[model samples]
Target: MDSMASAPGKAILFGEHAVVYDKPAIALAINKRATITIKESHKDYTSIKSDNIGLEAIISPETGLKLKKGEIGILNYILKALEFYHDSKPIKIKLEIEIPIGAGLGSSAAVTVATIAALDKYHKRKTTLPSIAKRAHKVELEVQGAASPLDTSISTHGGLIYLNEEKKIDQIKGDLKDSLVIGYTQSEDTAKMVKLVKERMERHPTIINHIMDAIAHTTKKAKKALETNDKECLGELMNINQGLLDAIGVNTRSLSDMIYTSREAGALGSKITGAGGGGSIIAYSPNRTRKIIETLKRKGYNAMKADPSKKGVIIEH
Candidate 1:
């Protein structure tokens, strides 16, 4: 028997750092997706293996992740959620996935959403997107420590979303038809970058005020543009956003170079897509989508054009 479920990857089109401080952020689920496939095996316990990240043993559903030799990645949200409701059975589950990791595009969150959704469906359990989102958010918090709940929200509930400061999620149901160019810089360790920001937040509180203030300004302006249905204005606000992120000390040489070069290629707006210190850049192009992609690739950047995927999780059995 084969069971499958999938979730979309996401990018923060509007807010990032400011969201941590009582500010709203806009996010969208991109076409990139993570898939979890669980099939029966002859083994006694559940096991997980990824096409890209290789193999690992599934942890016991009773206790969370174990510290054994082959248990490094056993805490997948699918297994954890199964354990959460004491629904763990001694059935062998094989895992297969295709979401690109560490691209700052909500890859892990998408994986969690997809995995948990699959598990719930497999057991014939009822769970809504919001409920699964909260569960996935908790798992991410376990990993990132200080992670906001935005990624999990969008990954589970797809389409463009306007997330409030209180983590209340609402879908932005308007015509979000803007063409987006996503580029992967693949520089800087994501975890190390998070640690740096955390360290600065702990050591130097004064400097963060100006940075957060600037992010708030851009985020607010972007939200207003969205409200007005002005795609061009939204693109312009995205450019301002990159500047603010640079001020916040998260922008790195790779990220900065890509953002600047993307602008020179006539992109209407450009910013680092995720936790920038080298992740990916999301650029909006008002005129020529192919030209924008071609320009980035000519400059040795891996770029692709993508649209917001409206559907959240798709499951099949």
Candidate 2:
């Protein structure tokens, strides 16, 4: 018997770095997903395959096998998920993801959630979304050393999520599907970028604190904008939020150019979506998503039109 599961990626609409400081953030799941399929195998060794990342390796749960450079970090999630089930039966697992890696799209969280959900089904555990989310968060913390519950929660629950520093979740009502666009730049080191922000905050607490407060304020206003269906106001707030992100030194030249170019092309608003250094930008393009995508492509950037995901992780028979 084989078991399969999939989870959606996410985009942080407001409050990235500020969220780390115990502020609130708003994130929504995208249509793009990461899928994992697992099947009992005749072989004695557990193996993994991924055509997307060009990885194929046999793993030993007993003695611990060595993984390739890029595979070690991601494979850790799979190894951790496997620990939930006590079976030593060898299994073959395959992963396929639609979102770009390291593009601030929550690829890691999606993959981890899918892996855990699939394995849980295979083991007949029938775990709930909240449980899966908590487990996935632990996996992320194990791999990244430090992590926010936002990514794992969004991937597990799907839809729009309002998360506070206290790890509380509120489901927001709104689907800005037709109004979203994502632009990708070169991959950035998320851990390194996060460290840079911490160092800067330590050096100048007052200045950074004010900027973080402004971002927190924007997130609060953004919730109101969504509730009132005020696209214009929401777009303006996104721009302001981006400015605050820029003040904190997360913006890179490529990311800045993409944001400005999207705005110049009549985007209602544009901002970096993640730990920014050069990852991706999210834009509110109510009627100009096509134009913005085309403009970004002409500038030699990868771009995509996105919609919100309404469902969380799904198990397939």
Candidate 3:
């Protein structure tokens, strides 16, 4: 039997670095997804392959081998999923991901969750969303040394999610699709970026604390904007949130370029989407997505018109 599963990528609409400080953060699942296929194999060892990351390796389920160096090191998360479920049967696994790696697009979370979902189904173990998310969070923690449940939760449940300091998660109801444009600055050092923010906080705790409180406040208003379907208000909050992120020193030159360029091109609001020293930026362009995409691309930046994903993980035989 073959088992296939897929999970969507995610973006932080409001609150990035502040979320680490236990501040409220809002995230949306994007249309892009990472998919995995698992099939029992007759061979003695299991093998995994992915052209997207140019990884091909065969390892004994009993004793895994060392993986190649670099960001593809994230495959450790997938391997951890297999071990978690104790499915030792030799199998062939294939992964295909639409999310960009290290761009703060939840590529790691998507792939890890999809891997666990596929393995669980392959072994005839019907797992719950909370269970899958918990296991995926472990994988991230082991790999990143730190992780927020927001990415794993959003990848597992999809749609719009609001997460607060107490770890309460709510699925906000609204149709936010087609109202945002996402731009990538080709950042490959999320760990380094996160470290920069931590250093700033170490140097100025009081200032960082105030910024975190402001971001939390903006997140509450963001929830109101979503419930009331107020795109303009949401845009304004994104602008405010971005300013706070800039004050905390997470904004990079490339990120600022994308944010300002999109705003100048008629985006209602724009800001860095994730661990912002360098990564991706999001712009609220309800009516001018095409114009925003064209402008960003013409300026030689990687850009795409993005919409929110309604479903989390989908399974197929």
Which numbered prediction scores highest in TM-score against the true structure? 2
How displaced is residue 279 in candidate 1, in Å? 0.8
lDDT (Cα, tens digit) per residue for candidate 1, span 1-317:
46678889898897776676666788988887888877665654566665456656555556644433333432445455555643555555545554456678887788888877877777777888888888888877676566778888899888888877677887764455657888886645455666776677778788876677777777767777877778888888898888877766788787777788888888888998888877798888755667878888998888777788998888876
lDDT of 3 by residue, 252-295 (tens): 88899999999999998999898876779999988789999999
- Give each model's clash number: 0, 0, 0
- As for TM-score, the candidate ahead, 2 or 3, is 2
Error of 3 at 123 (Å): 1.3
Could you give candidate 2's per-residue lDDT for residues 1-317 as a string of tens digits? Answer: 78999999999999998888889999999999999999898877888888887767777756556554245646667777776543767899998889888898898899999999998888898799999999998887777767788899999999999997687999998759688999997667677787899999999999999999999999999999988889999999999999999899999899999999999998989999988999999999897899999999999999999899988898897
Per-candidate TM-score against the hidden true structure: 0.87, 0.95, 0.94
lDDT for model 1, please: 0.74
Q: Which numbered prediction scores highest in lDDT against the true structure?
A: 2
Clashing pairs in 2: none
Task: Give lDDT: candidate 2, residue 251.
Answer: 93
TM-score of candidate 3 versus the correct structure, residues matched by position: 0.94
lDDT of 2 at 315: 85
**Could you tell which candidate, 1 or 2, scores higher by lDDT?**
2
